[model samples]
Target: MPTLESFFAPQDNIALENEAAEQEAHLIAEVEETFMKLIEIREAKFMDMMDAREKKYRALLN
Candidate 1:
């Protein structure tokens, strides 16, 4: 049995390596998408904060 397994081991290893590479690439893409969404949310919040501050300053001046 061991001898039979050894004979097929190289093919099995190649298949596993390909699967791992595919999974890694998928995970990296997901992480990048999530990061971009977070950045967009942050920029929106910052813009809102600046607008509110500008309104407050105008009210003070008036």
Candidate 2:
């Protein structure tokens, strides 16, 4: 049977490296997607608050 350390040899090492890189890319993409969604939600909420504030100020002026 092969030792555990044997897996770290050239061929197997390359495979692990590729898998790790692929996973990293996938995680990065997921994070970016979630961040963009959060940004959109934050902007929408800010706009809503600004609109409400404008209405309140207008009411006070009347």
Candidate 3:
């Protein structure tokens, strides 16, 4: 029986390299999307707090 190394020895290494590169690119894109969503959520919360503060100050002034 042929060993695992012998079986893979004749295969094109470039295909494996390309597959790894594609997976890495996909992972990076997912991470970037997640980061951007988190930033947007933070910004929304900050805006909400600012609006609340403005409402409170206006009520106090009135």
Residue-pair clashes per prediction, in order, are 0, 0, 0
Candidate 1 segments exceeding 4 Å error: 1-8
Model 3 earns a TM-score of: 0.80
Q: Write the per-residue lDDT of candidate 1 for residues 1-62, one digit (tens) a residue.
A: 36755766788979988999999999999999999999999999999999999999999999
Task: Report residue 58 deviation for candidate 1 (angstroms).
Answer: 1.0
CA shift of 57, model 1, Å: 0.5
Error of 2 at 13 (Å): 0.6
**lDDT for 55 (candidate 2):** 100
1 or 2, greater by TM-score = 2
For every candidate in turn, the CA RMSD to the true structure comes to 3.4, 2.4, 2.7
Global lDDT scores for all candidate models: 0.93, 0.95, 0.89
Residue-level lDDT of model 2, residues 1-62, one tens digit each, is 99886858888888888999999999999999999999999999999999999999999999
Once all C-alphas are superposed, what RMSD does model 1 give against the true structure? 3.4
Q: Local error of candidate 1 at 60, Å?
A: 0.8
Cα shift from native, residue 27, model 3 (Å): 0.3
- Candidate 2 lDDT: 0.95
Model 3 worst lDDT run, 10 consecutive residues: 4-13
**lDDT score at residue 53, model 1, on the 0-100 scale:** 100
